[model samples]
Target: MNQLNYEEISTEFKNYFLNNYRNFIDEQIKEVKNSKFLINVSDYTSETIDEPHRIVTNFLKEKNIKNHRITNLYKTFEFEFDFYLLMLTFDERRKMDIELYEEIWRHNQKL
Candidate 1:
Protein backbone atom coordinates (compact mmCIF):
# COMPACT_ATOMS: atom_id res chain seq x y z
CA MET A 1 0.00 0.00 0.00
CA ASN A 2 1.17 3.48 -0.74
CA GLN A 3 1.88 5.49 2.42
CA LEU A 4 2.74 8.68 0.61
CA ASN A 5 -0.81 10.00 0.70
CA TYR A 6 -1.51 9.93 4.43
CA GLU A 7 -2.05 13.66 4.67
CA GLU A 8 -4.34 13.68 1.69
CA ILE A 9 -6.29 10.77 3.10
CA SER A 10 -6.61 12.48 6.45
CA THR A 11 -7.90 15.67 4.85
CA GLU A 12 -10.56 13.77 2.97
CA PHE A 13 -11.64 11.97 6.12
CA LYS A 14 -11.99 15.26 7.96
CA ASN A 15 -14.10 16.73 5.21
CA TYR A 16 -16.22 13.62 5.25
CA PHE A 17 -16.82 14.10 8.97
CA LEU A 18 -17.93 17.70 8.54
CA ASN A 19 -20.27 16.69 5.77
CA ASN A 20 -21.83 13.97 7.87
CA TYR A 21 -22.36 16.20 10.88
CA ARG A 22 -23.60 19.32 9.16
CA ASN A 23 -26.80 19.65 11.13
CA PHE A 24 -25.13 19.49 14.55
CA ILE A 25 -22.34 21.80 13.54
CA ASP A 26 -24.71 24.41 12.15
CA GLU A 27 -26.71 24.37 15.35
CA GLN A 28 -23.49 25.07 17.24
CA ILE A 29 -22.66 27.97 14.95
CA LYS A 30 -26.11 29.44 15.31
CA GLU A 31 -25.78 29.27 19.06
CA VAL A 32 -22.58 31.22 18.89
CA LYS A 33 -23.98 33.75 16.51
CA ASN A 34 -27.15 34.30 18.44
CA SER A 35 -25.65 34.38 21.89
CA LYS A 36 -25.34 37.88 23.23
CA PHE A 37 -22.41 36.98 25.41
CA LEU A 38 -19.86 34.25 24.95
CA ILE A 39 -17.82 34.82 28.06
CA ASN A 40 -17.49 37.27 30.85
CA VAL A 41 -14.02 36.94 32.26
CA SER A 42 -14.81 39.27 35.10
CA ASP A 43 -17.67 37.10 36.33
CA TYR A 44 -16.05 33.85 35.17
CA THR A 45 -19.11 33.00 33.20
CA SER A 46 -19.24 31.45 29.77
CA GLU A 47 -21.71 30.51 27.10
CA THR A 48 -18.72 29.58 24.97
CA ILE A 49 -19.34 27.25 22.11
CA ASP A 50 -17.86 23.79 22.16
CA GLU A 51 -14.87 25.10 20.21
CA PRO A 52 -13.73 21.74 18.90
CA HIS A 53 -17.12 21.39 17.26
CA ARG A 54 -16.79 24.84 15.80
CA ILE A 55 -13.29 24.75 14.33
CA VAL A 56 -13.90 23.88 10.68
CA THR A 57 -17.41 25.26 10.52
CA ASN A 58 -16.24 28.50 12.06
CA PHE A 59 -14.18 29.46 9.04
CA LEU A 60 -15.26 27.07 6.32
CA LYS A 61 -18.65 25.92 5.19
CA GLU A 62 -19.50 22.22 5.18
CA LYS A 63 -17.98 20.60 2.11
CA ASN A 64 -19.45 17.65 0.33
CA ILE A 65 -16.52 15.27 0.02
CA LYS A 66 -17.00 13.61 -3.32
CA ASN A 67 -15.34 10.34 -4.19
CA HIS A 68 -14.38 9.84 -0.57
CA ARG A 69 -13.74 6.24 0.35
CA ILE A 70 -13.05 5.83 4.07
CA THR A 71 -14.49 2.40 4.78
CA ASN A 72 -11.20 0.59 4.38
CA LEU A 73 -8.93 3.58 4.73
CA TYR A 74 -8.93 3.16 8.51
CA LYS A 75 -7.21 -0.19 8.10
CA THR A 76 -4.19 1.71 6.91
CA PHE A 77 -3.71 3.08 10.41
CA GLU A 78 -1.80 0.76 12.72
CA PHE A 79 -3.36 2.15 15.85
CA GLU A 80 -6.88 2.98 17.03
CA PHE A 81 -5.72 6.34 18.42
CA ASP A 82 -5.81 8.22 15.16
CA PHE A 83 -8.98 6.55 14.04
CA TYR A 84 -10.76 7.54 17.24
CA LEU A 85 -9.32 10.99 16.98
CA LEU A 86 -10.98 11.24 13.62
CA MET A 87 -14.34 9.89 14.75
CA LEU A 88 -14.67 10.49 18.48
CA THR A 89 -17.77 11.99 20.05
CA PHE A 90 -17.39 15.66 20.95
CA ASP A 91 -16.99 15.07 24.71
CA GLU A 92 -14.39 12.34 24.33
CA ARG A 93 -12.47 14.39 21.83
CA ARG A 94 -12.37 17.27 24.29
CA LYS A 95 -11.18 14.98 27.05
CA MET A 96 -8.30 13.86 24.87
CA ASP A 97 -7.44 17.48 24.30
CA ILE A 98 -7.31 18.31 27.98
CA GLU A 99 -5.32 15.21 28.79
CA LEU A 100 -2.89 15.89 25.98
CA TYR A 101 -2.13 19.50 26.87
CA GLU A 102 -3.36 19.92 30.46
CA GLU A 103 -5.76 22.58 29.26
CA ILE A 104 -8.69 23.06 26.98
CA TRP A 105 -6.60 22.91 23.86
CA ARG A 106 -7.79 22.14 20.36
CA HIS A 107 -5.01 20.80 18.24
CA ASN A 108 -4.13 17.93 15.95
CA GLN A 109 -1.33 15.40 15.97
CA LYS A 110 -0.53 13.00 13.16
CA LEU A 111 0.97 9.64 13.79
Candidate 2:
Protein backbone atom coordinates (compact mmCIF):
# COMPACT_ATOMS: atom_id res chain seq x y z
CA MET A 1 0.00 0.00 0.00
CA ASN A 2 1.16 3.51 -0.74
CA GLN A 3 1.31 5.95 2.09
CA LEU A 4 -0.01 9.41 1.30
CA ASN A 5 1.69 12.44 2.77
CA TYR A 6 -0.21 15.14 4.57
CA GLU A 7 0.37 17.62 1.78
CA GLU A 8 -0.97 15.19 -0.78
CA ILE A 9 -4.02 14.46 1.30
CA SER A 10 -4.59 18.14 1.82
CA THR A 11 -4.20 18.85 -1.87
CA GLU A 12 -6.73 16.14 -2.62
CA PHE A 13 -9.25 17.65 -0.25
CA LYS A 14 -8.76 21.16 -1.58
CA ASN A 15 -9.20 19.87 -5.10
CA TYR A 16 -12.41 18.14 -4.20
CA PHE A 17 -13.87 21.31 -2.74
CA LEU A 18 -12.98 23.44 -5.74
CA ASN A 19 -14.12 20.87 -8.29
CA ASN A 20 -17.55 20.31 -6.79
CA TYR A 21 -18.28 23.82 -5.68
CA ARG A 22 -19.75 26.92 -7.22
CA ASN A 23 -20.01 30.42 -5.77
CA PHE A 24 -20.86 33.94 -6.75
CA ILE A 25 -19.00 36.98 -5.42
CA ASP A 26 -20.86 40.22 -4.99
CA GLU A 27 -19.27 43.09 -6.86
CA GLN A 28 -20.57 45.41 -4.15
CA ILE A 29 -17.94 44.05 -1.78
CA LYS A 30 -15.12 46.53 -1.89
CA GLU A 31 -11.69 45.30 -2.81
CA VAL A 32 -8.93 45.20 -0.23
CA LYS A 33 -6.20 47.73 -0.86
CA ASN A 34 -2.66 46.30 -0.52
CA SER A 35 -4.21 43.19 0.88
CA LYS A 36 -4.05 39.61 -0.33
CA PHE A 37 -6.81 37.62 -2.00
CA LEU A 38 -10.20 37.46 -0.43
CA ILE A 39 -12.46 34.45 -1.00
CA ASN A 40 -16.10 34.57 -0.13
CA VAL A 41 -18.85 31.99 -0.46
CA SER A 42 -22.52 31.95 0.25
CA ASP A 43 -24.79 29.13 1.24
CA TYR A 44 -27.87 29.41 -0.89
CA THR A 45 -28.62 25.72 -0.74
CA SER A 46 -28.65 22.96 1.81
CA GLU A 47 -24.88 22.57 1.41
CA THR A 48 -22.68 23.26 4.41
CA ILE A 49 -20.11 26.07 4.27
CA ASP A 50 -17.51 24.23 6.29
CA GLU A 51 -15.73 22.53 3.39
CA PRO A 52 -14.78 25.70 1.57
CA HIS A 53 -14.00 27.38 4.86
CA ARG A 54 -11.59 24.62 5.81
CA ILE A 55 -9.65 24.82 2.55
CA VAL A 56 -9.50 28.61 2.65
CA THR A 57 -8.63 28.66 6.34
CA ASN A 58 -5.68 26.35 5.83
CA PHE A 59 -4.35 28.37 2.91
CA LEU A 60 -4.55 31.48 5.04
CA LYS A 61 -2.75 29.80 7.91
CA GLU A 62 0.09 28.74 5.61
CA LYS A 63 0.49 32.40 4.65
CA ASN A 64 0.81 33.39 8.32
CA ILE A 65 -2.54 35.12 8.43
CA LYS A 66 -3.71 33.39 11.54
CA ASN A 67 -5.74 36.37 12.58
CA HIS A 68 -7.49 36.56 9.25
CA ARG A 69 -11.16 36.62 10.00
CA ILE A 70 -14.01 34.61 8.50
CA THR A 71 -17.43 36.15 8.74
CA ASN A 72 -20.82 34.59 8.29
CA LEU A 73 -23.59 36.80 6.97
CA TYR A 74 -27.06 35.40 7.22
CA LYS A 75 -29.71 37.87 6.26
CA THR A 76 -33.32 37.72 5.19
CA PHE A 77 -33.97 39.37 1.87
CA GLU A 78 -37.19 37.72 0.76
CA PHE A 79 -34.73 34.81 0.57
CA GLU A 80 -32.53 32.87 2.93
CA PHE A 81 -28.76 32.79 2.39
CA ASP A 82 -25.57 32.60 4.43
CA PHE A 83 -22.33 34.21 3.39
CA TYR A 84 -18.74 33.50 4.38
CA LEU A 85 -16.01 36.07 3.92
CA LEU A 86 -12.22 35.89 4.13
CA MET A 87 -9.83 38.82 3.99
CA LEU A 88 -6.12 38.35 3.21
CA THR A 89 -3.08 40.53 2.64
CA PHE A 90 -0.19 40.01 0.30
CA ASP A 91 3.33 41.37 0.69
CA GLU A 92 3.15 42.90 -2.77
CA ARG A 93 0.88 43.63 -5.69
CA ARG A 94 -1.49 41.03 -7.04
CA LYS A 95 0.82 40.68 -10.05
CA MET A 96 3.80 40.11 -7.84
CA ASP A 97 1.81 37.67 -5.83
CA ILE A 98 1.40 35.62 -8.98
CA GLU A 99 4.18 33.29 -7.96
CA LEU A 100 2.56 32.51 -4.66
CA TYR A 101 -0.83 32.51 -6.28
CA GLU A 102 0.52 29.93 -8.68
CA GLU A 103 1.23 27.75 -5.73
CA ILE A 104 -2.39 27.88 -4.79
CA TRP A 105 -3.28 27.50 -8.43
CA ARG A 106 -1.13 24.42 -8.83
CA HIS A 107 -2.61 22.86 -5.78
CA ASN A 108 -6.01 23.65 -7.13
CA GLN A 109 -5.04 22.33 -10.56
CA LYS A 110 -5.69 18.85 -9.35
CA LEU A 111 -9.36 19.62 -9.23
lDDT (0 to 1) per candidate: 0.40, 0.34
lDDT minimum window of 10 residues, candidate 2: 80-89
The TM-scores of all predictions, comma-separated, are: 0.27, 0.22
lDDT of 1: 0.40
| Number of residue pairs clashing in candidate 2, backbone atoms closer than 3 angstroms, sequence gap of 3 or more or interchain | 3
lDDT (Cα, tens digit) per residue for candidate 2, span 19-108? 433221111122222225443222212123344455456654554444322323653332211122221211212233343344444444
Clashing pairs in 2: 36-88, 36-89, 36-90
- lDDT of model 1 at position 62: 38
Candidate 1 at residue 101, lDDT? 38
What tens-digit string does per-residue lDDT give for candidate 1 at 49-95?
Answer: 34443543432343332222343555764543333335544554444
Backbone clash total, candidate 1 = 0
